[model samples]
Target: MTGDFTARVTALLMPHLILAPIALPMLTAGLMLLLREERQRTKVAMNVVSTFLGLVVAVLLLVQAKQPGVQTSLGVYLPGNWPAPFGIVLALDRLSAMMLVLASTVALATVLFSAARWHKAGVHFHPLFQFQLMGLSGAFLTADLFNLFVFFEIMLAASYGLLLHGSGRPRVAAGLHYIAINLAASSLFLIGVSMLYGITGTLNMADLARGIAGIDPSDRGLLHAGAGILAVAFLIKAAVWPLNFWLVPAYSAATAPVGALFALMTKVGVYSILRLWTLMFSSGAGDSAQFGSQWIVGAGLVTMCFGALGMLGSQRLGHLAGYAAILSSGTLLAALGFGQNLLTAGLLYYLLGSTLAVSAMFLLTDLIERWRNDGASLAPHEQTDDAPFLAADLVHTQGLNLDEKEEVLIGQVIPAAVAFLGLAFLACTLVIAGLPPLPGFVGKFAMIHALLNPLGLGSSGGFVLGSGGWALLALMVGTGLLALIALTRAGIRHFWASHDRAAPKLLVLEGLPIALLLTGCALLAWQAGAVMRYTQATADALHAPGTYVQAVMSARPVPNSPGTAPGANGRPQ
Candidate 1:
């Protein structure tokens, strides 16, 4: 009887699983808002449980998406049982599922890390965090453009709260600029969406793709203009080139865990570009096909160059992490612009690895800086200890006793805490620099190999790298070198030069997240073959958007001239 009951419950809940990732967090955030700020413990507990549930659901969704058959693997949930192109729908395919999982993983880590101290730094941190997760999950899963704007607003608003959580001068100042910039971007977003709706009757992504081919000739220019404006908004959010100036200060000033969470925000923009570009602007887009490809590629390359220069020039670790995010975004954008599905598969892998590395670095930066300032002495230290004695001092010391002269220090001993920090820092450096034996390296190698050999295995055709491809190759290697130099300099300054400082007390809560993140990168490296296959499959699905369109549109009943056919739950059939 118990077994039968369990089976029945599973059957009942199975149909609604697609909504869990978004709904769970929204409900948790609402519950958290109801609680008083004094209920800190309760809020933390709720936050953890909600994020964990989200992670579990995302994993389950990913598994479902990776099933043997295409239609069976994709999951589409229509609220109120309403048909598509009319009512809201949430679609989960391979790409969306993968994004859901990645976002959840980062959200879980940030939440865990924040519980150590950041939660207490503000009154509504937990609620804001959950709301941010809701926004991110919703953005990933929503099938309509208007809802994407809604989710983007949710995400930006939550981020604004979280950015000002600690309330320092730098944080507030940066927050103001961040808010202003994003508000402008939001305005442009609305304008573009309006224009898009004006050109195309529907906001549903699949439906928009279906209608683009039949759009009137006069409106084609407007559609392209709308798309250009939309791309500008996304590119700014993605931290591409001059539009990204606000990123460094805002991200650097944010609290550590919030900063880590911000690492995923840029990817949200990149994901939007990928999803929309591939779906609505592919070869089947008629006059709109491959629109702005050259502009995207050019902007991405320029963004990468700027990011690399920023990393090289940045002195603070926080600032460096911000630039690292810019660099990662640029790389992914460039890959997308290339329009090679295989290369995009590798970029997906790169995106996952880079995001994990950047988050780990953000957390690690806080811990290191905290240690650097803790119990620091006010007295001025002797800077000339290693310098040769002055002539007067040398003469006096020589006359007194040659043996009594102060001896110069040989080497500094590495402390246990510093050693641990050094090792973790080294791992971060390797991952960010795309060094050997790490997932970063694997991803970059795959991209380069794909560029050099576009035909894949068993193909006899020869290929030549385009100028853009060569530029990409050079920038990839150059950025890695630049990162290596910057990170190495930071490690030495923090760990080696300051070796005499008291060892930092490592908290399990603080260290555990960083360790887990790096371990995840390592696991990705270990399972590269399998993960690459999955990413390739995702790439294939993205390139062929028709399958996705069919899956989503087919689920809805054909509408009559007046309205959709009447169906169950008052929804049109």
Candidate 2:
């Protein structure tokens, strides 16, 4: 009887795995909200368990997406058995599955880290966190543009709450700016969606793609205008330059765990751009083929330069990590603008590595800052002014103690907490700087290789790298170098120069998550070949979106025959 019950439950769930990623988080968030605010332990347990289940579901979906001989690369789910272009649809493809797993993994880590302390810093943290996951998962899975907007709003709202979780003066100030900017972006998102719906008369992404082919020539200009508006909103959220001034300050001021989660937020914009551009604006898109390619490339290059400069100028670790996120976004955008499948594969890999690295850096920064005399603030103040004198005084006070220096000192022993932090910091530095033996290096190298060997560009079957390619190559290398210099300097100051300071108290929960994140990156590096192959497959699928469109449209339930319509009970004959 128990075996029968287990089999029945598995059968019931087999078809709905696509919805599990989004639904689980939403349900958990609702449950947490219903619980009393003081039920912190219960909330934490529920959040962790939900996130773990989400991660497992995401992994299963990813594996299913990569299965060979599949009719469609995407698995589509329709609620209430509604037909396409009418009812809501959830679709999971390699790209969406990959994103789901990444988001879930990061969410788990952030939640665990927060459980150590940040959750108690405010009420509703767990619910907001779950809601944020719901938003992210829903955004990735939705097959309709309107649903995308809904999920985007959900994500933005949850983010606003999380950003203000700890409630300091700086956090409040930054949170307000973050809220205002996103609200404006949301308004633009609505305008763009309305315009697209007005032109196409449909909000389903697959349907919109099909409709674009039949759009009147007279309406083409309006379609482009709407897409352009939508792209602007995405670019803002992606932190494309001039418009991204709020990112550094907001991310830096946010609490550690909140900042870690914010790392995934920018990627949402990048993901949206990649999805819509490939689906609705590919070479198959008549009259709109590769629209705004040059603009994206130009903007991406400028963003990269700006981000590199920001990293160089940043004094605090938090600010550096924020700028690094922007740099990663710029790199991915530029790669997409190049319209190369090989580059896209590399970009996806890099996206995963960089997001994890940046998130880990946020948590590590908080841990390291606890031991600093000035705490986490990077502002120039009196303590900074007296730094040189303090160094000199310390040297005179301790280094020249001849009376007590009769015995020679042996090797200096490091504390467990300090050693762990130092090692984790080193891993983060290598990953962020794209150094060798890490996934960061592997991804960047793949991108540079693709750029150098452009396919079918010359009579010899290989093309010389363009001026733009060379410029990008130089920018990537220079950016990595700058990151190394900056991080190395910071590491020495925090760990070596300040060795005399007491080690920061690290909790098991906090340290475990950080270690796991870095370890995951290392494992990715070790299995780079298999991971790249999967990413390359995802890139191929993205570039050719017919499978995605077909899967979604075909998943819609068939209508009844002309003579066999709905009966009095509304049941189909």
- Each model's lDDT comes to 0.85, 0.84
Per-residue lDDT, model 1, residue 205, is 93
Tens-digit lDDT track of model 2 for 1-573: 999999999766666788788789899999888999989899999999999999999999888778874435337776646757887878878899899989988988999999999899988999999999999999998989899999999999999999998888999999999999998888888898899999999999998887787889999999999998999999999999888999999999998999999999999999999999888987688888778877887788888888888888888999989998998888888777776678788899999999999999999988988867534323345347676566557656666432243322443467899899999999999988999899889999988988877673321221245766787788789888888888888888888763435556789999988987897899889999999999988888887788878777776454555776442111110
Off by over 4 Å in 2: 1-8, 69-74, 374-410, 456-465, 558-573
lDDT of 2 at 116: 94
Clashing pairs in 2: none
Best by lDDT: 1
lDDT of candidate 1 vs native? Answer: 0.85
TM-score, model 2 to reference: 0.90
lDDT for each residue of candidate 1 in 284-315, tens digit (9 for 90 to 100) = 88988888877887888898888888889989
Q: How many backbone clashes does candidate 1 have?
A: 1
TM match of model 1 to true structure: 0.90
In angstroms, give how far residue 226 of model 1 lies from its true place.
Answer: 0.8
